[model samples]
Target: MDVPEEHSYERVKYIPQNFFETICNDNPDDFETELKKVIFSHVDASEKLGQKSLEELIDYKSQVLLKDITLFQNEGGILNKDIIDLEKKRTATYRKSIEEGLSNKKLELANHQSNKPKDVAKLESNGDYQKSIDEEIKYKRAEKEKLEEELNLATKKKSEQKIKQSNLERISQAIDTFQSQYEKLKTDNEPFLKTIGFKFEDAVQVHIDKNAINTLVETVKIKIETLSDSIKPDNENGLAFKIIKLGEEITNLQSKLDEPTKRYQTYLDDISKWEQREQELIGAEDIELTLKYYEGVLIYLDNELENDLAYKREQRKGVVSQLHEKKRAILEVYKELYKPVTGFLEQYKNINKDYEITFDVSFRLKDFEEKFLNYVNQGVKGTFYGNKEGTVTLKQIILETDFNTLEGVIEFFDKIIICLERDRRPGQGNESREIQSQIKNGFYLDMYNLIFNLDYLVPYYELKLGGKSILQLSPGEKGALLLIFYLILDQDDIPLIIDQPEENLDNQSVYNILVPFIKHAKSNRQIIIVTHNPNIAVVCDAEQIIHVSISKTQDNEMSINSGAIENPSINSSIVQILEGTMPAFEKRELKYTLTKNNMHSIPV
Candidate 1:
């Protein structure tokens, strides 16, 4: 209400961002329309026009009108209904002033048109220009005064412009220095980032995308990790893909070997049965000849088929060896990749420093075991095994196992993922091919990102106030801190009406902590609170004491009695209410006497 230097919509952005949402949620049902208008005043978003709310109000780059816009100030802070209403009031005042000016202009124009001929006649008649000498001089002096005011305004503007230019120069120099240092940091870190991936993109994306930096990072990480599953077996790739194809080839050979082996065994059995029955046959000679012929055919078959089986087995063995070689090569690649990370971790650990963002964030590089265990314990929501009810999980095994190295931990995770893929994949179709997945262990956790390489972690964003996290602080302590922040640190001079400051505080706590704070805070802003403690009200010497009584029987009528402690009636009311009655108050007064240093107890 007091500050009208800026537009109400713009000024409202100064308020805490959450306060807007809270107030909107609390708004009456009928004011829903007004709430929407208030929200849109900051960024009028629509399907057709996008969000160019202030396009009409603000000229973009002094030329182009922005068609799409989003609020970037104060993390998307905007006007509320109250601010919009205030803006409306200001607009109405401006419109009234403009209308008045137009009316005055019309009247002045009419007077000028009517008096023009007379003015001309006066000017022609012996140089009598419709004014006395004194009046004409007064008129010239008034004109000179207006011109002087304009000149003074121009001089003031010139001085202000020079100051602005000087400030801009300093700012520009600081910006250049910042960019130089940032480029150097990136250059120093370039080598470490290249081991896991060939490409390097920004760690953060556009701020306007609400789900930008972290979300995009996670999405890209998942896609990169799961990229192997997406690739068809027909797709040509390196060692991993070759290993899968060789595995399938060996499996086919194993199946083909079973056919030849089974057929050769059947042929032997028939020849043996024929030999056994030949001696007892009526046509012994013919049977013996048949057996001999069959035996000879079996000999030929054994020679050809045995050679074929041996050749097939040898070929499968060669494929298996190749598969093993590919696997070993991959392991070697993994070791090479891990060296940079391990080195990065060691370097990061050796250095000790705190990097501050908008909040207090502490980061430390987690070792192989610590990082692996944390992720596994938290659970992996893999393609085959998800972190859901009844889902096959790594958590159980993770809790049981004590990991020694990153390689060993990853090997175990790879086995688990491989087993899950094999179990879940169906036979004889494209679905089975996903078993050749590339994501192994913690690679999905932005494996190539420097943060991953360093294995730096904060666990969660532990925002601390006074070196204590919110989780560590009790409700009273949290409230107290918030109150202190609002009163002392926030410094906005916004009205703070604390409903029961001593709600959770004990009497001693109120006196020791809150009483002194409120006393000091009162000098800055009025501290209004609903408190019943005599130590707070009486000791602090309240400027006003209000005795409120609610009568529910009489249509919930509220009666308020207000006065200072100096007033007899107010003092009596305070004693009666706070001390439970005048008799009890007098009894307490007789027992205890107030003093500067300490209250003394009288002997009973």
Candidate 2:
């Protein structure tokens, strides 16, 4: 026992995995309500209770227990939001999933197929959600026409851009020819230009006017420096005349160049605009894919396109039907969820016979109706405008009705829900996605709990303590009950350290319940109780007793006196320390003669 090798452990914060708790609460504080923690907590670590299948029990409640409780509760009705929501999502989302490529047509069809109630007496008894397909067709056709018109405009723009580009190229050619002639004229007589005193920097000036060139050629420098300093002016056939001839030719080319130059720039700007608009219609990126995608969507939209979309839609319907059939087949033998509380209760009953506790889970239809309407009211509170007339009708119907059958209840709630809906934002119904991901896990089973469903249920749970409800029990009784359970069922070989267990219980109640239990418990394991009560210390037949005391003279010093009832000094100290305690034992002795025949042994 002293060797470290015999055991292993790791330190942990908060409650450990085994649920071995330090029972510190002096009073019974909602232990009945916290039955899950109580039973499953590995404090007692019972093999029988631990071995009980929580899964099996949960199944039993919703399946087997549901039948009895439903019929017993208020005839038959929906239990909580979870079971109803689960049924709707399963029926609406997964089972009747109708999907097509690149559209919400399938999802709409699926929603219509699954979530909607097919037949209620008030529902005009129309064919099951016929609007899903025909409405889709109408909407698609409208969209298809709009896109087609856009595509036609884009095609026309493409043609216009091509035509404009060609016209621009011709204008550009005229401008280019003028440029070539002008460049040739300059280069053909480069020496003449330099001699004419034109400041042709590294290259000719980018844009030159014939007038400017003419002004340069008439400079005094040009007249003086023409040929070997022969300064002259005013000759029609001389160097000045030759340079003037060059200017005249440039002026003629400039006249030809003027018309196309502005027009060429205008064409460039216009083509850029045209191409931008073209890119918008087709796409800047993914132009090929975009066109192909448009073609596919148009085909789906076109009634006369003569494609396999109908076949595909039909195939989807067939799949939905098959899934529906499978769901129905599964439902015949399976219940959605059964809380394992019933199974838990069965084990709890055996764990402690002294525990006079009983629990009942019931399904109430009236509660469901009230809850659903409350939900409706809350949903309508802030909405600016809605289907008020529809809501009024639904509320009235909900207010006036007691739905008898499960089908009737579901249909009624479905209608109410439809009326309560707002102009939903995108992703409004994504709860179905979340629920779908959780199926068949332990969480899925918890959804079907009759009494509760993870904030979703009003499944009724009735817990009774001592033939009266745990709720009806007084604080004292609750405290006493908590104390007894801790003392009785929690008995084990490890030292049971209790500080004044008698403090909460009345003295008589303590003697009756605790003493017998502690005596029986002590046979199996050690019981360490800190108490000031003399009746407990003497009557429990203690083999040894230790009295702890602080030394009066020395504050830091402490002393302990140890012995049984036979030890003199310990007896003297016990009398002095427990001064008033002797009178109660004296009265008890005087009231009844102390004989072996007078005493009766309590049953363990």
Candidate 3:
């Protein structure tokens, strides 16, 4: 059966009283007849199954229309019936205006014809009068030709004036743009100049020559005037040619201005580099003094000829005391920072039962101590302490280890001090060798300094989930987990439209896990799912179903049928198409089994 067009039908539950009252206000008999004709013309026997006669069908259609109109009024604040009435009034008013205009034109034409001269035949019969009339006609024709020539010349002059006015406006706009750019350039560069310790005015003068800019502007003005004067009314090139040439000159001037701006940027970059170099030089001076002081103390400890050993030992003890205090402070800070990581791991373990995860933060001092001692033990007795034996093994020096106590961290620093003092003995000629090169190139003292620097050396926090890092999870598992996390944590009262949430999920997972979650979630928010899955529609007990079908007619025009499941025909079609013919009958039998008989004679 062919369905009626969607536009001609409205799905409404009830009709309002105002609709009937309005219909009755008009000719009730004619209105009912017309409404019945419209209803019968579109609806077929299938659609009229529940109705008995034409009047009942008309009443049903009227209820639908009245419900639609009421909905329209509620949404758009304008009644459909009132709109129709206004449109009728408007059409009548327009028709009356056109009729009145036509009548006035006809009356005026009749009066004009009555007032015209009726002596044309008499004038034609008299030869003298005819000759005089012909002469008057010739004179008028000559005067008209002269006036036409003057009008053509005036129009040409007006057109030329318009072209000149447009060119002037373009020039004015270009000047305004140039002025704005100049002011913005100056403002943008002011802060950069101040940052680099140059006066803004001085930098502007040095980089952007004002005199040159003024000269360029003046030259452009002269060129504009020269081109304007050269524009002739009959010139084939036209004003467009002059305007293009003006634009080219302005572009050239802009290119010239760009050079100074580029130079200013270069100057700012150079200043920044020089300031960084100055900071490096200051740091180098402090490092030089520190190395010299350390060298002097080592020399005092080594010699018994120049100084008392007790005084040197006392000074060394004082330095060691301070180093111990710094070590304690570093360990305290590391423990405090490690608390958050432990708390997060505890929470993660509680939530994710299937995954076994562990996290720990501890200082890596034992690792550094082992590496440093290995380097010292492998060193030769002479030749700058390691020049003969070569350098320490890189793999050995970069080991990862954790320490539980502050005493272990302190003991690690003591080993590093002993190694450095032994390398700097007086007879070894170590003072002549660059201290930085010796430390960095051979044993990598910078690595040791990094370990010593409290800000640089913090505790390492390691994480593992299900005996494997999170990065080790397969891509599909990761995607599923991320989706589950978002759904569980980020609940909000917004409609979530998920297209095929069961795409990669197994059938069991959809029926047991996803369906229940969606059912619970729908209680708090609306969800619109577009799917081909029958379980999602039937098992979820969806409140409304829009069964949509597309087909093409013989004319090759596309037709779309969309209706709600509340309609028995639509509901049956959805079941037949989505769940197969057998399931549809099973559903029907479940509903009407008690009243039905066995159909043994019916063919499958």
Alpha-carbon TM-score of each model against the true structure: 0.31, 0.32, 0.25
Query: Residue 70 in candidate 2 has what lDDT?
Result: 34
lDDT score, candidate 1: 0.42
Q: After superposition, how far is residue 108 of candidate 3 from its true place, in Å?
A: 99
lDDT of 2 by residue, 1-604 (tens): 6534544542211221112122223322334234434333332233323334433333433453443333333311233332344334333343233222223443434444454332322112134433343333335434544544554554455455455555555655656667886677567668766888774445555563355434443442333344312212355544334444544543343334334342442343345445544444444222433433444444434443223433433343333333333323323312222123334345555444554555444332334433333333232322212345434554565555433334444454444333333322233442222222323333333322321211122233344556665446554455545454554444234566656666556767666656665665667656666777756666667667787878778975889888897788767666665554567657666767645435655344
- Residue pairs clashing in model 2 are 58-338, 58-339, 58-340, 62-338, 450-459, 451-459
In TM-score terms, candidate 1 sits at 0.31
Cα deviation in Å at residue 245, candidate 3?
87
Candidate 1 lDDT by residue in tens digits, 332-420: 43233223323433333312122111122223234543344333322333333333421333344444433333443345444544443
Q: Report clashes for each candidate as comma-separated counts.
A: 0, 6, 0
State which candidate has the highest lDDT. Answer: 3
lDDT of 3 by residue, 255-292 (tens): 34334443433444345445544433333212432323
Predictions ranked by TM-score, top down? 2, 1, 3
Q: Each candidate: RMSD to true structure?
A: 43.5, 31.0, 43.2
Q: With candidate 3 superimposed using the best TM-score fit, by how many Å does residue 59's alpha carbon deviate from the native?
A: 70
